[model samples]
Target chain A: MNAFIVIAVCIVFVYTVGFALSLWKQKNKIGAMAVLFLAVIALVLPYFSYFQS
Target chain B: MKQNEGKIGIRDYMAIILLTLGSKVSDDTPTLLYKTAKNSAWISMLGIALLSLIPILFLLKVFSVHRNKNLHEINLHLFGKVMGNLISMGVLLLGFSSFVLDTSVYVDIIGSMYFTRTPTLALYILMLVVCGYGAKRGIESIGSAAWLTLFYLKATLFLALIFAFTKGNLKFIFPLWGPGTLEIAKTTGSKLSIFADFYFLGIIAPLVSSFKEFRKGTLWAFAIVVVEITAALIIFVILFDFTSIEVISYPFHETILYLSIGFLSNVESMFLPFWLVAAFIRFSFYLYLVVTLFGGIFKIKEFEYLVPVFIVIVLFLGIMPKNLTYTLPYLREMILGILSPLFFILPILMWGMAKLRGDFKREAEQSH
Candidate 1:
């Protein structure tokens, strides 16, 4: 993976974690979980060679 | 006249419509139309408007009964929880993807056409931040900003078209049916999603002050956008002719570049700010809709909170593709293709569901 892609994924991962924590604090567990799930998918999405195009 | 709190009046609603869909002319939308219908893109636009009427009218009928409910709520009411949420999820996925791809296109436009040296990521972030701020402020703010700037935006656009018309030749529009009758009809069918903005407008349907005003504003905006876009298509064909225009990526920007007002050789700079304002409002509205739908689906009351998360997601996704000029348009065309059928069918389906459940009849009985 390109260094920029790696950094982008890391930034996204951090934002997702922070966001999920905030949502969890606010008692919105569902929203938090949804965010984490989506974030993971989004993070992994770019790495797949099929999607690279 | 006292304005309702948290709701926009007819003029504001119309302004939102005008800015959101009307800005399509300046984007790759005309290119999409020109690709298939060629010089007859305007005819295909008219065909799109005519064909769109059925679904739009059906959507209106559906909204007329569910007066206070937005699209998601209406889906839940008509389709029950499981199915309604499922349908809304599908709509939201399409809507969000469109937002990401469309914003990339605009960012690419800015990067490629105007600011040649600016980094695409930098431009994308700046644009998304402004739009995110607007979206966080909510629809009333977006609508008001749109209404505030509608005049100047349209005026600059009008002047550009007027100048283009003057520079263009009437003879270029000859061989009017550039492809064939069948192709034009097909173009009309496939591009029907050009008016999908109206379907998306259901998210804010209840935000309008009254059903009467919403209906009036919607129809008025629809008529104006059709005429404006069609006239723009005709002028573009006259200016560049079909061959060159079909290949041109962003004709409106190119036209503005080609235009010179008296001694002013470069007028595209003057038009840029207005287009930028319209673009900001357009995405702000789209961002607002996407989060709103996302919130509704997840049972989150304050969907506004999702704005930042989405902004970040969109920014990252938007900048992912290596060659945006080729990639964004391809993704956009695919999205449009998927959305076209859904746009045409969903409203009719909603109306059908409402009819079966006798919601309209109940509305009539209640009204009487």
Candidate 2:
């Protein structure tokens, strides 16, 4: 349960950072890339490691 | 002619910092520090207090470089419009979320402790109306109100502590260092949220009369921080055994309730009104920051017009959270941990970069 909570927290943190980056680079491709990177991390990291159990 | 060209005196700035520090001290720190650090909470608070100076020093550096510019204006100059706006928007959202979470927790405490029959939504609405009125009055009114409230707020807090003084046990505070230094440091990190309000200082610093006043105000603010933490630690040490303090939800409020005058009794009721006033000031300041940042980011000329719109949005968001239990922790972890740093760190970094690029010197010259 703690692991799940930690994972959820990380996902939320990454998502917020990505969102801010998107807003940061409104016209730049880097913003989109940042968002994509965060999204991928959010989706994959939890399932693959400590939260996998 | 700047919109808010009125320069506030040193006293006014002192009052603002006192109110800001006082607001957080009463609402959260007592209970939170008690829970996290247990019997050794006082030491933990001291540690946090010392660590908090880092952020203040960082803020002072930022203020020295950009004498009178608020975070929004500084960011725009430093990062350019798009990136700056992005950072400012993040800050706005972070402020908004914190307001909602803090207000909700306060309402929950009120409802649970005092007005059991009142629906939480009603409490939120009532709070919003009061805070909105303060925000609409502008910074001068807010600062003046803070000044006025400081006297009564401090008096009531002291009175409550005195009432609880007889019941305190010094033995409960023994073994000054907790289980380990590592544990104390970890708890210090968690309690660092109180200083998170320093982010708002960036927005408020320019409103101060002069650089000297701003520095003095921050020093006074830090003093208040130490006094509040010490007083709260003493109160918690007296009221609860170490084991019980850790499990308690609102240690300070619980202490207040445990306090009793010979005949009057129920003094916590008196505290509620004064505390509500402080909370209103705090909530309004954050709401105003959100609207102002949103306007600055989007290039909207009149942020004041968005006041009503954001009030409605704030009301909606405040109500959307299912309950205090779920929302409060989420806010502490996600909002404070992640979003707040963007507000505090980004501005300082941007200011540094801008200094490197000669923006601060150029702007200073232009203004002169």
TM-score per candidate, chains pooled: 0.93, 0.80
Question: Residue B77, candidate 1: how far off, in angstroms?
Answer: 1.3
Q: How does each model score on lDDT? A: 0.88, 0.68
Worst-scoring 10-residue span by lDDT in model 2 chain B? B300-309
> lDDT per residue, candidate 1, B250-354, as tens digits?
999999999999999999989999899999999999999998888777777666766766876787678787776677778888998999999999999999999
Write one digit per residue (lDDT tens) for candidate 2, span B153-250: 88898888777777888677777775667777877776665676776667767778898888888888778768876877767776687787766666
What is the CA-based DockQ of model 1? 0.25
DockQ of 2: 0.03
Q: Judge candidate 1 at residue B176 and give its lDDT.
A: 79
Q: Count the backbone clashes (under 3 Å) in each candidate.
A: 0, 1
* Chain A TM-score of prediction number 2: 0.47
Please report, as a residue range, the 10-residue window in candidate 1 chain B with the lowest summed lDDT.
B1-10
- Among these predicted structures, which one has the highest lDDT? 1
